[model samples]
Target: MNRKIELLAPGGDVDAIKAAIIAGANAVYCGLETFNARNRAANLTFDDLLGVISLAHRYQCEVFLTMNVVILENEIPTLVKLLNQLVNTGIDGIIVQDLALFHLVNKHFPSLLIHASTQLTTHNEGQIGFLAKVGATRVNLSREMNLAEIKSLTRYAHDLDVLTEVFVHGALCIAFSGQCYSSSVSVGNSGNRGRCSQACRDEYDITAAGNKFPLNLKDNSAYFDLPELVDAGVDSLKIEGRIKGAQYVHTVVDSWRKQIDKFVESGKLLSDDSNLYKVFNRDFTNSFLKGNLTKDMFIDNPRDNSFKHANDKSNAISVVQIQEAQQTLSSDKDAIVSLVADKVSQLSIEKISLSLHFSGKLNEPLTITAVTKDTTVEIQSAVTLTLATDSRIDEAAIVKRFKSLKQSEFELLPFNFDGLESDLSIPFSQLTQMKNQLLFKLTKREYIGAVTLPALTHYPKLNTQPTLSLLICDEKDVDLCDVTDADIYFKLPESFKVNDNKYIDIFLRNPRLIPWFPAVLIGKDYLESVRLLETVKPKRIVSNNTGVAFIATNMGIEWIAGPFLNTTNSYALLTLQERLNCAGAFISNEINRNQIKNIARPKNFKMLYSIYHPILMMTSRQCFFQQTVGCNKPSIEDGCMLKCEKATTITNVKGISFAVDKQKGGYPSIYNHEQFLNIDAVEDLSHLFDEFFIDLTDIGSGSKAKIDKVELVSHFENVLKGITESKTSLKQLVTISTNAQYQQGL
Candidate 1:
């Protein structure tokens, strides 16, 4: 508390932004209707965002814009145009998820501060190093981390001069952020694209635990854990409610504001937190931060729990008492709304008003006095004005040249030309220079002209024919590697024993099996993985986790970025190859043919694609069986990750089902019912790739496929080898497959 901790609030709209500012928020983050994660929220327009930044700065509150969604190939031009305009807005920072943005901002727009979004799934120390290397000044830690984990990562980040922020109050996601594909697979709406359908909250058939909404978790509230977070050395305490209305934002931000103030002032905590309950929430829990993954963290209902909390707090047992409690809660909510409205009524986000007064003589320089209510700036043309008849500085020409000022924070009023004599002219270039100078003086920042990124050189494939690769996890399938000449990738588990040498011995014995790391690794698990990497000293490996990639890059080992890193645009490819020394990468399967066709590959870097694999819906550190088939353990234990091998299907009310599979030493994950088999990519874009990979592992199969693994590999290889008859045989072999994602790109 003694340290200056920032209180960051969410601004879904103009009112919410004003409410947070009036409620004593130190910073506010919001989106601008496009290229942000909260597309469902009432995001601000570009013009409104300019005014919001101006207003927030007046109150000493910083504004951070959210451009956190993955950028597609076609959107880069428009995104660059927006960035050019944003560099002059005095925005404090830009929160981003795409690696392409990091590369773009670091190389072209270095003046813009970059904050890594939670979608990056930053959990381990090496991931912090990775973010810092990629130019993130601050990082949003994954919500699943505990106090000790946070403290350790924060210390590491601080050593690198990077700040850390924690999500103290918000809705909790069961799956790790950026790793969830449940919405994308269930519907065409992808969470990565900010079109999540809330599949976790959908009604499902009752499980053995008698729960209908099993995947729903209680909202996260670390209100009482301020002291511990302070001890953890986090720089900011972020509140997540961009989807909530202005009233919710005001009430929650105000309550936390008072709590933070009291704690900072007296080092004593506030006990009453009833104000937070008056808003929308699914009850509240701090179990994740406590490192206790109990079943109680989940709520059977996903709606607002305020009414129930009130009735329980009032000890209402009878119907009349319950009715009275409900009435009181409604009245209190109304009172809060009225109070917030009154407080925010004093705030305004209107554009700055400007009045221009032009005065000049026949021989002196043409001077334009820019006047505002707060200040005035007088700028003159460099050259002396001269008498002219055909081209004079008239009101029509001057207004046309200065109209662009209205696009920014200033609104130009009617121009005044009475003091200036007619038939006096200056060069058009001089007029533009005066306008630029005036902008610099008014905004207190130098004007940045538009920048154009040079087009990357398109490298052609050295080998025209793409190679075939297969992925396998179990040692039983290792014998299949001898049958084909394709490269084999060995899948590693999410958890590792303290001194486990089982994987080390496997890699040492079979030099051809390349290690494939998963997307999520924390604390000891991450360290053990690093130990294996150092012990084996593999020539090459494929990694989905940035933490693992950072270690590999530091050790001078060749690494290929996995598809989960969400490589979509060309700049992301450049970031991996140029910055991280990555030798190869897999383009994301979330995009379609048109979106994939425009990406220019870097020289000497290989582009890989997955033509056949089971579609992963989500992965979680929490137990999925507790509310499904019913586990005897009250919570997940250390042994669960190394011992649990449970697989079950959860059917929704719409009659669609998804398979939940948990292998030993692996986190529980959900998979789409049908496997992904994109034969069209092979037929259409085979020339653009160097490798077409397939997962022959039984991780998500769950007794679905009866075909022999060896025969399936042969069929896929033959299809890739241009065997006319093998296409039909391959389709028949994998009957329950779809290529819908390839057709419906994000």
Candidate 2:
């Protein structure tokens, strides 16, 4: 942004809001009760939001409410209620992830600005442009981007009249935003739904490599990149810690504020007091900023909820100022009491009354009584009355005389002052002295009330025996499925979604097979696609998103949780099995071998682990092929369907090629360049998981060379049969693929 850069901080609660303000941030982003990415944080209610907006406005700061979560069909009405109440609150904007929420807010509450959440996985201009067309005022770039990628997107956004916001400090996710499935697969709770278990923070034990703590990524700190980010035309510099305590928020905000000011004046970073505000960071990494895969982004010791310590030393912040915030918390009866008190104190107000009186005699007395809300102050004044030589006081004059409550405890209200004679002589100067008596009493602070949140958890156990699942794209690939050994699932293409019979016809020619539903048939696509698929009534299915899971459950069909559901932990898997009533679920491709063992399964359901497959890196309605070769599709729903039949391999600066394939509804699902392979450790993980899936979409995805479908299937069968190959022979067939930090960790 060419204008003054806005410093955005997190307001997890009212205390954090105040701390951000006191710490000198230009804007604060917070969640209201529900539907936010960090639902575990102490969110504000409808009433709390009114006071929050009022307080933030009072301090000349903006408040952007978080509506960043995948919308469940049942939660729409509640979301509408929240949006309606938010309209009148004069909230600066909203941070959202769901497309439904974005559309609803844009259509109904035109006054409210929308800032797309990073959970939307916005990386490039095409995605950001898609959001801008939907009325996003700003887009939070994905944390997985390099500086070059960010510069390009920011530049593109500037042309579209959209602002760019990037995280300058925060806990970085190992998976791309909107793509990580580790939490959901493990616990049925979703990162997209704001209940992320942060499985990336967990330790992993790789079978082949000696890397013990593989997935724990170092937190991101682009602090020194302040000037460059500002120069990169970012409209806002953000700090990400809504789940943190107030002192941490204050410390981070204060440090960034000072550094920003220093950058503006000196155009250089601070080296001297660097350790003063060490930011409680777990060793920082700018991995995506430079495409440095060799960088040490993994953490040896991951921080948990129990890790509670704010200051590193006195050098962290100015001593006197830090104590003021500390003392406010210390004054409370206990730790919990202090937290609740801070939330309530945010909207606290003083109670008071104002009175005016007059005697029948012209010079008798004109009395005023002022009392505080608590009755702590009772001031009675009978000022010296002046004799009126000409005109006497009228109703209007009386109202004016006592209405001057500047610096008073009580708010002004309309009251009848006709009991006594208003036609009396009184010096206005006498009224001035009366107000001075109640100054101290009016200046005391008070609070509104504390908001409560409910406890949350996922399901327990459910498991099924192993069934070799094969994911295919065409009718020819379906013929290769050996009915005697494996269960086949064909991913329905965008063209076949409305009429699965085309693929069903092809499948019936060979053998009856399960249908793999689209990963992103959201909104109308969800309703229509589910309607058509129900007619086919396939015995078994693959559930892509939560909506599909609901649809499948309603029809009483057996479903296996697909890779898109993001099942990484045992809790997430338990959630999917018991909550969604799923027969089986796939373990997240994001986790290593030992992490899979941690998710102890239940007896009723089966778990499928992918030993070989191209990991889907990103998914979107904006097709890459359409973007590359011009498509005149007026909206996301049209024009690009047939264009996406041919897969395009997009190569980045680092020569990493991402395979882009479009599923039903013209949505592009991008896969990583290298395939994931762990053949040697296959037999070892067999006890933990039952079904082993090999997603064969890679067969048709156009690359320099294509693998024979028969060979890939046979390779899996051979490994399953306990057959071993030489080290050199294994790499030639499977070992030479990327594990997506299955060893290095993201």
Candidate 3:
């Protein structure tokens, strides 16, 4: 049996969701109040999400939650908690973008379904293969693909046993997926973070030689063509208006529903009698689906108003006129006139006969007997008047009198005449032709025009002036200089000792550090332990994942740890002055460059650089192993064992299981040990006297594990030489240290 194509619709609010479901949608993708792509939609809360899940499941429809935004370092805890809650609520699947988040979820909640977000911009076969390797079940193809490309992609993906989904109808974005920079450049907000301000929709002017050109509107209409992306082979059809109103939702859903049904019933897509334009539409086009989209596809034009007032107002008018030529009418002659109107209603002819009287001989009017046309109507008392001119009588006076009578009201003069023709049709073909031509030209022009920026300068007449500010910061506090110049200091414990039997005491102190000063201190004992035990630095260094957590708490490094330091054991004390200084420095640099400034802090510490493996998802807690149990099972497929879920486990020498979930829709997990050897140096550790601690979180898993097996005293000599040769910059050191500490929860 052939599976019916899935119809997916947007549910910005409850009503829209209900409407879509009633209209026969197979699935609905929506966002929760947090971490959803649509930040502006009065999105569903946790309760609402649960409710929606129940409702959709009741209808045998699947509900997919969108947690597609990039996860920030600080937001990991909240995200993890949310994921746990969502899993417990029986949500069918999640759509996500950040790889780290993907890994985290796959590691912790492996049973949950993961769908790769379109924002990943997977366009080619290589990208698809990559996603497949990472365990992505379905890939939402980018809207920019043409029909042939989609067909090729679908075929390729099908061969790999991966499901492919495509967008069929909705608001079309002007930029390529994952490649749009318009929002960030215009508003200092990244669309990847769900903070886009829709700068693309604003009106702009294209200026050359100081003359501004209107790029958005031409001939009083928007130029962009809304695409309808249906094809016979598409697995799912998605609509794109999550921010639109319910009316728009209803109309679009209804129209597309009809189209899909008709296609299913008859294998025909478009209908000549369909009222597709009655829904919310800008000029309709096939987009790049057919091939290279022409200039006409981008044309912005005036909106059609046919759907505004649900009525037809076109009416017709009639005009009647009489013409005559020189000829004397015979006594049997009668006059008739025909009037034609275009599609007229309530039409009636009040009178249709003519009368004539003659006065030539005795100053008395001579009554006519009859008037007929096509020998049909006879006027018995009219015009027995003949065209013969009496030689004795005055012809001019009679003619003049007849003309006066004819002109008096609705009368016709007795005159010499020719044959008459009636029932002429009105000409409306010219008007119809003109209207169609105008519409076509306008649509074409909009697609060909380039986008422009709008002018928003203040006018003096309006009594308004634009205000702007310039800011600057000092360099010393921004970690641009060496640690000493920034007035930040670090000290290790007098004696660092590490052994498997005893907990190491590697104290970190920053007595002169000011409050809020950004600094990191990695104890030699903890670093050496990770280096020897894990062999590779953990991808993230936080209290939850490291031995440094207890050490940082005992040493009290919280104050000077600034924002990046996650451990509470090893603390750096900071003064209020240093905090202000760092902030000032960051602001000063931004002001100089005319860019948005970032806050600053202390200079030296340990740093980790990503080497060979991709950083999957970042999280506040360690949950990957717990989520892998149910995910790693093999399913019987075609008499072969196939991994149905994205879970993989690597056992350590100690026989501890480490879960690796490489699913596409969830957080991505990094592997291989090559990424850990890039660390260059450790700063502010000269006091340790030729002994610098190496943190394994800065290296690959295998490397960290290798480091764990060797004692610092035995390998110290070669490690020191390797560190010096690495040419690690102060920034790189700090980056690795901060990331390591964060992962360790230090």
lDDT score at residue 570, model 1, on the 0-100 scale: 88
Clashes of each: 0, 29, 104
Give the candidate number with the greatest lDDT: 1
Model 3's C-alpha root-mean-square deviation from the true structure amounts to: 31.0
lDDT of 1 at 337: 92
Q: What is the lDDT of residue 107 in candidate 2?
A: 48
| Stretches of candidate 3 exceeding 4 Å from the true structure | 206-232, 270-276, 301-746
Whole-model lDDT for model 1 versus the true structure?
0.92
Candidate 1 — which residues are off by over 4 angstroms? 387-397, 422-425
- TM-score for each of the candidates: 0.98, 0.50, 0.42
- C-alpha lDDT (0 to 100) for residue 555 of candidate 1: 99
Per-residue lDDT over 664-693 for candidate 2, one digit per residue giving the tens place of the 0 to 100 score: 435555565556666644666766677778
Tell me the TM-score of model 1. Answer: 0.98
Could you give candidate 1's per-residue lDDT for residues 366-420 as a string of tens digits?
Answer: 8999999999889888999898868888888888888878767998888998889
Q: Please, what are the lDDT tens digits per residue for candidate 3 over residues 1-746? A: 14577777887766566556655678888887777777777677665665566566667777888887655544555776676566555577788765545455554666677777777655556445545555567788776666666776777787777778877665555544444433443344556666665543443332221212111111111011212233335567777767754555555666677766776677665443223344445545554454433333433333443332122222212221111111111111111000111111122211222343322223222322223231222112112222333332233433443332221111243542222111211122322333223223322211111122222222111112111111001212223122222222222111123443221111112223222111111223334433322332222222211123222332433311121221111011111112211111111000111111111112332211121121221110112222223212122121111112244444332332222443321222323222222122222212111122232222113223222212322233333344453343322332322223112210
Tell me the lDDT of model 2 at 395.
64
Ranking by TM-score: 1, 2, 3
In order, the Cα lDDT scores of the candidates are 0.92, 0.62, 0.39
